[model samples]
Target: MKELLILVVVTIFTLATYYLVEPFAHSQMHKHVESEHFAYNDLPKLTATGDATRGAELVMGGAGCTGCHSIDVAGMPAPMDAVTAAASYGVNPPDLSNAGAVYDAKFLAELIKNPAHALLVEHKFDMDKGQMHPMVAFYGTGGDLDQEVADMVAYLQSIAVKPEELTPAIAYETVCGRCHANHYAKWTQIGTTPTFKYEKESLAFQIQVLEYQDSLVKYMGTLPPDLSIYIRSRGEHYIETFMENPQNYLKGTAMPRVGVNKHAAEQVIEYLKDSGDAKRHEREEVGKYVMIFMVIFAIFAILWKKQVWRDLH
Candidate 1:
């Protein structure tokens, strides 16, 4: 009787599962899949057969694309001269060859529009390092300049260079030069780092700084609420320990533990504590407050001028 009962239950489950799930399986429409297959999965898919004729003009124009890449467009020269010219200013351009082969036009455009998704995958989504930078930042997470990225992609796709063509010096120039364009960038230039002094400042500034820290942490999908104020509240060792292994410090924390095995965590501590700007986050806090205030003030002024505020009384 027990054997018969087990057989009956199995039969019911099999019949029910097949009947209910089979029809849905054919369409798979239940899952909201925007795109499962990346057609630009290979270089051949992205290679353009159309006129890259006008693409050259867009490259040299105000887009500042020559800022990153070395294009072999019709009007422009090969590379050595143009690249050497830039090295004088401690700038090295990136290779544009085979870029089309590496990514499709759409992928290229998205990369420029929003670097967060375009970058090295280890930071977040391991699958997408598509055409984005790992270290360098661009638009996304409130980033922009989409049109420029489009133009830049057009230029990159026109060229067809090989991997060996990218030299070590050129690699450093195109990638790292974007930000550290001034100091710490010039291989020939070296000096003693100056200690900034801004220990004493406005509490309001400090508070906003704290908030900005929180925003960055939130963006990274790690610990929320920044450590700016913790200098006094939590102390240096507290910072050091968390920096060492944030996961260890906070169980089940999203912080993926960056530099515990190496002494990188300690180095970060030294860098942060000494850097006086940490006490006063210039762009992060103050800029955010200014932007928010401007938006609010504009709304209020508009309402007042239009007599909306008066009518409320």
Candidate 2:
């Protein structure tokens, strides 16, 4: 009788702990991001219609974006390699290949107007020196800022790659691998390693790409975290929300607002769900049986105890 009572108390305590502590534990991970949330539908609409063709012209022209970034569209040639660009700038600028698919148009326009303002980055000016780490305002397209931004946004959307089918692994490699190299490398080691799509590239060029990736830590101040366990550490909603507007989620974080649309975000999240917990389905199935066994065992134990104590009573 005493043992059964102890078991009951233990089970209750465990359930209480899980119900109470789980929420607090989850909240701590997102404490930095907590704010009065607003629906995205409430935001203001864009003023101008985007034009991809003209946007490509701006991207290639003296807006000087190409000077910093590397675009790999079919006709566009990267003027400078990734390594050279990262060496020149403190960080490797993001690839704009998927900009159309990833970013919000209004967000892109705001960023172009002022990078620091878009990011909400604080700046302290020194009397001896001018503004430090200031991104040059892009007023290209003959100084018509509105038209320039509109064209850029249009171009980004136009150039977005659409695939009939995208696997979780493919999404991770193409979208998330650039920054999360460690996670990619680890995942590759565990699973069947994927063949490089650029296998036809010259050996020297491949070497240069590898070297550039290795040197990213030098420029990025710290290597961005591996995403191997990111899905587990940060839940799907947190990841999706963060990708949408990093500044809103984690103030002062260096993670720029990515241009991923809802569909793309879902794809990445689906992939994460699989990659992060390979045994999730199996565990859930096992849990049901375990609970049933425990219940049956408890009943049997109680019946036996009652039988043993009836004589004493």
State every prediction's TM-score relative to the real structure. 0.26, 0.66
**Model 1 misses residue 86 by how many Å?**
14
Which one wins on lDDT? Answer: 2
- How much does candidate 1 score in TM-score? 0.26
Global local distance difference test of model 1:
0.43
Clashing pairs in 1: 43-101, 97-161, 118-132, 139-143, 140-143
- Against the true structure, candidate 2 has what lDDT? 0.63
| Residue-wise C-alpha lDDT for candidate 1, range 1-313, written one tens digit per residue | 9999999999999998997777757447432223212332322223333335444555565444555555543334444433243333222333455445344466555454443343323345343556323224443232234544544566565574434443433332332222222222222111122343665444444543334334433444542432333445555565555544444356555443221211223333434443323545565778899999999999999877889657766
lDDT of 2 by residue, 213-301 (tens): 55666644466676766778888767877776676666666665554445666777777777676678999999999999999999999
Error of 1 at 101 (Å): 2.4
